[model samples]
Target chain A: MTDAIELPIAANSDVVLVRQRVRTSAQQVGLSLVDQTKVVTAASELARNTLVYAGGGRVRIEVVGNGARGGLRLTFADEGPGIPDLELALTDGWTTGGGLGLGLSGSRRLVDEFDLDSEPGKGTRVTVVKWAR
Target chain B: MERVPILKLGDVLIVSIQIDLQDQGVLALQEDLADAVVESGARGVIIDISAVEIVDSFIGRMLATIASISRVLDAETIVVGMRPAVAITLVELGLSLGGVRTALNLEKGVALLEDRDNARAVAVPR
Candidate 1:
């Protein structure tokens, strides 16, 4: 990774900052307009999840490379009450927050790689990557 | 909390979102639009999001909610000027904006509203 930045996700405004920072990193990594939009949108969803579900958290935006290919990676971590069921949480239309429940599932579809980890009493961490095409 | 401004044009209320709207701003806009639709007695509401770069689940939901709210107030809602990339990202994000109508740009959106009004006028004979 050449450049990595961390931003807080404590409030609604912070989520907007996360999205802007991710979009900049995605563009710097040579992502196309559509690819930039995809990664940024995914980042927005995860950042909001950190705030709404976990109370507050932080996100690390990184520019990664694999030989000649470059990608943008985002890691959102929060210490709030962790999810009990990973499968159920990732399922579409299943939400406890009265939302559409598409944040996790839809974000997964927008990126090339997605990994989520959470411990009931511990915390939750979600990492996603989108490569430039 | 920065609020998105709503402009009035003829019998339509136009809201051009040019900022990276926070969640609070989105909610405020929804309320503002509902009020504007009623206060102005607008027959149509046009939301221009051409300047908006991304539309996450929250923003997508805001659009749908605004559409529903305007419908309840007896005004048609049409979202216009959505960037191609934004459209693609929204679909991939699993938000089709189901109840919200869309147009290529503001001009087309206005024309659509006008056509609907004309059709309604003929049908009602008033």
Candidate 2:
């Protein structure tokens, strides 16, 4: 069975909410403290990206189990201007905003699975997953 | 708006962040801390983040900026009481927080500041 929670990502406060929910879900899946932190931090980065780049969107967090392993999966979907170059965007130190440019690449490094899809003038969707050891 | 309280302890400034910070809130804190450093002539600033569980890139940059501001103002800044989880996340996020000194807790942070002060005093001629 897959259980998911949907959180709105319109405002800055929603970023914090996403992090908290992600942490709770990570803990519930028996993720180690370090693993928990990594997933939550990734969620925070993606949630912020959704708010800033996508002009606000929604995130779906789900808990999944595979045999003896359990994991958490997060999906961030936005309807704002999508990225034109997914390759350059994934490069470190590349940012369209006045940020440290660690939102995309850094978050990708923190999780076990990552996927990105964006179409210019359309929107962007990012999915990441981290499994418990 | 929630504001992080900056307390003056002798020639040091103590800021304890007890709540998760919003974008505006972090900006306000940056302003307030800069003003406090100038107004109080504090020689050191100790920030306690034990109560804060998360520090994204925004908040991470805020800490680095605060440390930079304090350095320019002739004050030392030390971040203390970071949760282990936060530390792990910060490293994975690739924010090394360069130029910022950190301590395990407030007490050690104060001691580190004092050590610096004493070393300076001993090195300088009267």
Pairs clashing in candidate 1?
Answer: none
Error of 1 at A117 (Å): 0.4
* DockQ by candidate, in order: 0.91, 0.76
lDDT of 2 by residue, A1-133 (tens): 4999999999999988898899899999999988998898899899999999989999999999888899999999999999999999998889998899999999999999999999998899999999999
**Candidate 2: C-alpha RMSD after superposition:** 1.1
- Which 10 residues in a row give candidate 2 chain A its minimum summed lDDT? A33-42
Q: CA lDDT of each candidate? A: 0.92, 0.93
Docking class of 2: medium
How accurately is candidate 1 docked according to DockQ?
0.91
lDDT of 1 at A36: 94
List model 2 lDDT by residue over B62-100, tens digit each: 999999999999999999999998898898788999999
